[model samples]
Target chain A: MTIRKTASDYSRSHEPIVWGLFSAGGVIVAFFIPALILLTSLLVQVGIADEAVLSFDRVQSFAQAWWGKLFILAVIALSLYHTVHRIHHGLHDVHIHIPDSLAIIIFYGGATVLSCLVFVWLLAIGW
Target chain B: MSTSEKTIYRKPYVQNQSASWWLKNKFYIWYMVREGTAIFVFLYALILMLGLLRLAQGEAAWNAWVASLSNPAYIVFHGIALIAAMYHVHTFFKMFPKVIVIRFGNWKMPESYLIAGQWVGFVVCTAVILGIGLFVGV
Candidate 1:
């Protein structure tokens, strides 16, 4: 007897999982990043924001807290996933051809590794 | 290998596109610009990661990291990043209404309201972050 394979035999795509993270990251970026950029960079340059606002003692204490660690991890990890997903697909827009599998491994894998590093670093900071 | 076990392959022709294809039209250019914002976002995240690493190193290292931001080049980069992030916000908010569908039973929420609500959320988030940084001491 001969067997036939239909579309259902194929495994599902992982696009949805990454796309969901990308959307969440987009919302985070839209709502939080401008103000963060202002606080970290432009305000400091123009002397409107005191450099001490980000002093080691204050920032360290904040980051050492459970909430602060969660907040930082969420922002960095989500943003990494969002941006790397964009950059991965953007390669095609510019006509830079690479195996899609390789691109996925490189971009998504890198984001995962970096996020893990951030989590580890946050723990090292301690409460 | 047996000849009957060999697989035959077919090659299909794909249209060749230039690397600068996006530069051909204004709309495409803007789309590319929107996508390009990812680079800035990625870099800023790296800066934060470096800051985190420095923070773990100790107060002196953290101070040095903060002081490094005072560089003229760093300021310029941040300025560009700020603009890019805002543009991202604009584009993202505009796209949100289409991406998410909301309705009240039979009554669907208008796109305008959805977009406006996002702006409200944005304002609230910005306020909270800035308020903490300014009044709460980081």
Candidate 2:
């Protein structure tokens, strides 16, 4: 849509790194988020998991398991990355332009910090 | 004849743009809702992360966390978040095919195949997780 294409006018963006994370996170959420909300909320609210499932003892042991830790890490980190990326671009599409440096530091930077915290918390309780 | 020349420019009309510009169009509104789903999804994730953190801290912490979730307000919030997450998943599946086009030697693989395959994979994975927990006594 420009009068002429110029070499200096176009450049590849480094978006794919975050886009990949966003896409993976979306896939993960698509696969599980609704079910997660359902199982954790509705089922627990009902008779299911009242005494046994998700009980303190059960949940603690589940978290202590390696597979449980991996699942938690993947879900939390990816979902945060996905959500922040969406919010960042969502602002742009709405014509709310924040400075790029600040947006990056806040959104992606926050994700990095939280993801690290998840890893640490997972480790703190020991195997 | 030497004359003073005046430059005259016509002012162009500009469309009204506002922070709520998306409200002007149905499609834009829908798109905004899709993007906004992430907020609810993030809220759900944050609560879950807190639950995980408390679970890691030990039985006392996990019990307190579970007790907190029983609040009426938390239940209401989770209800809204659940609905939003469902919409997010629906939009995610629809848009996923555009992200990666599957191609065969000459003809392209149909988008339907990819979408269906994703659902199948989702089912299999979910089954594996649940089955192990049940069978292994975890």
Candidate 3:
């Protein structure tokens, strides 16, 4: 006869993996934000036509371009995950009992949906 | 006790708390935010590389890539990303004063002032780039 492990046992086994993924994802997004800002600023200076700088026209062109949109999406998605994870942990630090699993699902899930929508909108504009 | 044992001996001890106790402390939330943002920066780098690749491929390929990004799903995704990125930046700038610790002679600079300076710098840089773009016209 075999003994079955309870939910606690499963959680104990999986907790580290979940935390690790959350941490890695958080770190990736955190680092991407500043870098993207810098890169975009530089790109605007060097790559785009002079008139496009700071204007919606430039933003439109960049947003519409495949490479540009992807770059923007990656930055947003990763950062969103990172921000949510950090906020979750931050709340936990303050003795808030916000369930870790639920927080992860909501924050990361929300980020995914938002990123997808933005990418679609940019594409639709025919940029 | 031998001569070598003459010196006072202290009892060995082990920490009772978990390894993450320091991070779990409420006061350290800001530090965590800073660290979290650092991770996002790395992800952005990869995105940049992809963009460069698309740029190198020439107009048709690049346009095709751009067209694909128009899907509604992607637009929503980017919108969330933008918010996340803004949060990261705001937090990073807020923490800048603490992390850098700049002292002017005997007096230390205020963190608020440092944060304000950073925001100003960001605005100036953005303005400069925009100005250049307007002058050149793509």
Candidate 4:
């Protein structure tokens, strides 16, 4: 079933909030992801970083730090929502149209669920 | 024939783009790649989230998780993810200028300038983050 939209309702769509999250997530991906890749993957393999860099002691310390927790929270939650928003539009652009309500619920719901989990886990880290 | 007397009936070519249009050309393929990178990025975020969860569980679990990172398969996965992330960064910067409008005195900022500004901001932000992390003993 289609809910009719007046001009104002159409104009005041909640999409911008998703778009804002998407854009913020894009910034996190751009600025931080390479460093993450280096730290977690390439550096240790290539021997530029010590194996201890990712050792539980150091990483846990980092995660327990206030800034680390905040940063990780932002990166995880924002990227999830960003990717979901992209997936939502990309699916539409590629002509995989389900009902709008269903599409929104699935895409946004998945992000929201995982984001809440991320927050809970971040806090559970005992900072 | 006077111009007003001519009645031309032209057939309208009503062609809707196919869903697989991105597969047809390099341009579309690249656009798809740019869009597709988001999933890999989301995966990376999930990986980090898992790491956080493991950290919360205590050293044994966290260390085991860390140890798994050295696996050849995990390494290769991360490498692909790294490429996807770089593509995301490049494309995100390219899109920045389109969304942002800036003026310098009477002149509008060029797209190149806008792109460069994003890079500069990223660099500065990274430095600040690293500096804080180090100084704060993290």
Candidate 5:
């Protein structure tokens, strides 16, 4: 067996994994558009756009009936992961050598924190 | 040369097939497009949050926010965001069939069919939203 000696070989081997990340990211993002539109329409209807109502009371009522919040969460979380993965590879192309484990930790860690913050904020506001 | 005396030919050089730009750089391009969309989405979320905050404040605040959005700079930023969003949507729908697998007993659906269904769903939803917005003035 001949050992592969080039970047092309490395990429060819890893193409499927890269494509999987991209495709999954895409589907998640696609679903988000309609979900977002629905959420916006709800906000408009509830006088959230016309009145001073930041209390959790308003959001809980909204989310109770609208299942779009879950989709929003998924979109944000998946897109965050997708962002980090793509950026990591881009940095690699520029000869940056971040250890794989450290990179994954940082990326996913950031995503988790951000997602948690979103949930907490929404819940705190009663959504 | 006589058939028996013929020398076997061996090519002295093999052309390098790996240096072409697309072959060497397509991955990078894909990375850029994907990451760029992510960043755009992040920015879009921020804008959306701002709008939500303003809405939560009051109608005056919401109107002010909409008015601000009418500024040239905001329009440009929103335009860029819209373009980035469309790119993300188009690319994502193209890949939808592969990521999620739905099996119906003995029948399996193809990816293209799934993507087409998604687009149809999107168009229908958009139409409904637009109809509601126009009819209700919301």
Candidate 6:
């Protein structure tokens, strides 16, 4: 027997909002994160990539550009939500009991605060 | 509402589980490892934020930040993070079809197709970023 959920039932839960961000962020991580790690850290260090790939002036100019700022913000903010959401649920799998409200505040709220900070820093970086 | 007449509700018993329960099963161990990638991702994000903070300070500060990444410890850390991120990509693509379904009329798109398309997208994205990093700068 199918027990259909009403619109009101959906609205009462935060699952949709958080799950949306989680999946979106997961896609971003899968597509972009490995490359980011390679570009920003590993390849250059190993001498397989040029040092100018992440030279101070190059990265600085990138951060100062509008699209570049948006890119940085999206990558950082979404990845934060993606990881924290997993960490929150992963805690439960490990039998650690955190009260729902408190967990939401700590994980989701913390992601939001950090995302805001990224946005602020991007703005501070200027165009 | 006299204190003697008030009834207290009893809670149901829940079986206690040790935090290391995942260690007992190979499948559970892999599951934990997959979830564990989040910690690496989170730490890397913090590192990027720190880089951004330093970038905002000045050229001297930014150069200092770049120099710091060359430290042996940070190189090791990034190596681990790079592996963790690749693992995340693998697990994410494996799980994506279950999360989102697509159908056209009577025929449904195969999960293999979805996974393959995602890989193509991932390769394209990686190439674009590599191009930008390698070619966009002076």
User: Which one wins on TM-score?
Assistant: 1
Q: Estimate each model's TM-score.
A: 0.89, 0.87, 0.43, 0.85, 0.57, 0.88
**What digit string (tens of lDDT, one per residue) describes model 3 on residues A58-110?**
55566667876775666565555555556556656545676756875776666
Give the winner by lDDT: 1 or 4: 1
Local accuracy of candidate 1 as per-residue lDDT tens digits, A3-122? 889999999988998999898988888888889888877787689988788888999998999999998999999999999999988988888888978987899989999999999999
- In model 6, pairs of residues that clash are none
Per-residue error for A38 in candidate 4, Å, reads 1.3
Q: What level of docking quality does candidate 3 show?
A: incorrect
Every candidate's DockQ is 0.71, 0.57, 0.07, 0.51, 0.21, 0.70
Answer with 2 or 6, whichever has the higher DockQ: 6
Q: Which 10 successive residues of model 6 chain B have the least lDDT summed?
A: B1-10
lDDT value, residue A51 of candidate 6 = 79
Model 1: DockQ score: 0.71
For residues B37-138, what per-residue lDDT tens digits would candidate 3 score against the true structure? 434443443444344345444555445545444455544444444554667657657755776788979999889888888777766655654444355454
Q: Candidate 5 docking category?
A: incorrect
lDDT of 2 by residue, A1-127 (tens): 7599799989999899998999899888888777677656655664554435567766666677898889888988999999999989998888988999999899999999999999999898677
Off by over 4 Å in 6: A1-11, B1-17
lDDT of 6 by residue, B1-138 (tens): 556965679888998878888999999999999999999999999899999988888789988888889999999999999999999999899899987899989998899999999999999999999888878754
**Model 4 over residues A1-127: C-alpha lDDT tens digits?**
9898778775556778788888888888788877777776677766776676677767777777798778788878888888888877788778888898998789788888888987788788776
Q: Count the backbone clashes (under 3 Å) in each candidate.
A: 0, 0, 58, 0, 4, 0
Question: What's the candidate order when arranged by decreasing TM-score?
Answer: 1, 6, 2, 4, 5, 3
lDDT of 6: 0.90
Residue range A1-127, candidate 6, lDDT tens digits: 9999888776566688999999989988999999999888888888988777777778878998889998999999999999999999999998889999999999999999999988898888787
Q: Candidate 4: which pairs clash?
A: none
lDDT of 6 at A91: 92
lDDT of 1 at B70: 90
Model 6 Cα interface RMS deviation (Å): 1.1
Per-residue CA lDDT of model 5 for B94-127, tens digit only, reads 7567768888998888888888998887777667
Clashing pairs in 2: none
